[model samples]
Target: MAGYPQWHTASEQGPRARNADAVSAYAAAGAPGITFALADGVGDDPGAGRAAQTAAAAAARTPVADGPVTAILNAQQALRKLGGTGDAVLVVAMPFTGGYRIAWVGDARAYGWDGSMIRKLTEDHTMAEYFRTRRQPYSPRMEHVVTTSVRTTTAPEIGTTEVVGGGLLLTSDGVHKVLPPATIDGILADPSRAAATLVSTAIAMGGHDNATALFVEPPEVDVAAIVTEPFPTAA
Candidate 1:
């Protein structure tokens, strides 16, 4: 079996009166990998913090054998069961043999850092991104408005991707929004303090919202062992 990847996470309420972000990571029981999940609650909702905590915990508990997409859908269901006026964006990453799988809803983001460059792995589900992709003009306010969230009445259109190589990063808008991509790349260059530095820097740079970051070093995969392992039986 392959060893679990090393990871670190940091979160701060920042300038916000309260924090509405949650993050979790653990070794997946059903697969030879680790699962990382994060949630950013909608600022306008009163129950946002609890909602984020619930969703992130639910997502992280999902077995990796089921895949990242299933992990996100499970989280959405969990939020609905909570039954409150709370909403949150979510991102889940699961690392496998040669690459990793990521799934997200709303604006929480995932990125790949290959030492020299940082690449965005998930697309924002915000109105601004929607307009930009369609080549339509939109107000700056649209940038903060997400089209869907974990508490939405309808199922969200989850964004997913698979990438090979490099380290992984997951962050709430508080971190990525305040810090430019170049600055993020610079912080990631040193993996030891990357997560803590990312959150602290965001706060120093006008943290109007909560900041959270989770960083994972690439796992050393034993490909031959993975190939020989027995498939998990149906539950």
Candidate 2:
């Protein structure tokens, strides 16, 4: 393994955002690789915000299971074990031996950047889409309102994806709803000032919700190799 995982994590309770709908994490020290998770609580439910916090921290504390798929399943199962009372979305990722495993549920998103291009790793699950299928008008609510989450009932339906060679970003809907894809790309590109800029922008944009972000940049593999390798065995 090479490149170290350096991250900038930050969150802010926005001006109009009543509840802190977001929770985040950076690379944990002396833990199972670099694991990060983020969650956005649905404001409609009273216990939703707390659910987000509980889910995010629980997910982060959990180790990477047999695989990404297993991890997602495990997280959903874990949330079910807890009294997850409201709708929420969670995103988790870790740098593995060969690549990275990224998984998500509900709407919180994961984004990846390979120096030039930034791509979204998760999709939104909402009834609005069903309405859209019927040629209905799109009605938007608080970005934190989610149709799916870790509730007290059934387990969460999750999604997973894999990526190699790039930096990763995780955020709640508050940030995505306020900024466009291009804007997110610009912010993540500047690793040095990305987190501060992101939180500031969300706050300035009338923060209608608690906005949080966890940006992870993988270090250069060659440099890590140079630092670790004992000797130049061959050319």
Candidate 3:
């Protein structure tokens, strides 16, 4: 099974009472390999959830052999099928024998944690990021400011990276906002128990939207140290 361990959790609270995020993945130990995808909808948009669902499902349905570009295109096509312009941002992770491939668009993010430190893997397409780079104040309100998303005329900016040996984490804005990155990194370092606690922590810390976290421990992992038993299917 490559000794990889993964955990996912989501919660809705504080602001957007309705969770507009969706996640889907197909992972196997042997032949086909591991593939994971997550999408988060713009909170203000009523149809964002549908767009996310459409995109995530599309990405997950594509052939496991497809590369990042092809997988993303397939997801875009799926959004089109739902009459969605792709107003949702998506993050995808596919684990192979050597490592994993990561691709993303919009604001949903991917984070990586080595044994000691955590690194952000994806850039956000939000205005706050622009402000941060320009040395300007980023109002908390700017969280709602999205520069790009899945839309008919707009092509999302895509970035791809390879994760060779590290813990990869993916999340919607809800999870990141409520939890500090260092805290998130610690959880990824020891994801088993922390994965479930994170969900509750977000909700407790005023998760004003749908909170989601996907933790992936790639090949060569010490599974015995993480997953002790099967994740509760109902959760």
What overall lDDT goes with each candidate model? 0.81, 0.64, 0.67
RMSD of each: 4.5, 6.9, 4.8
Q: Ranking under lDDT, best-scoring first?
A: 1, 3, 2
What TM-score does candidate 2 get on C-alpha atoms?
0.77
Q: What are the per-residue Cα lDDT tens digits for candidate 1 across 1-235?
A: 3444567789999877689999976554445665789999998355899889888888877877788888878888888889877888999887666777888989999999887778999889999999999999999889899987877624437888987887889999999999999999889888889999999999999978899999887656632124223322110
* Per-prediction tally of clashes: 0, 1, 5
Instruction: Indicate which candidate wins on lDDT.
Output: 1
Considering summed lDDT, which 10 consecutive residues are worst modelled in model 1?
226-235
**How many steric overlaps does candidate 2 have?**
1
Positional deviation of 204 in candidate 2, in angstroms? 1.1
Full candidate order by TM-score, most accurate first:
1, 3, 2
Candidate 3 or 1, higher TM-score = 1
User: Against the true structure, candidate 3 has what lDDT?
Assistant: 0.67
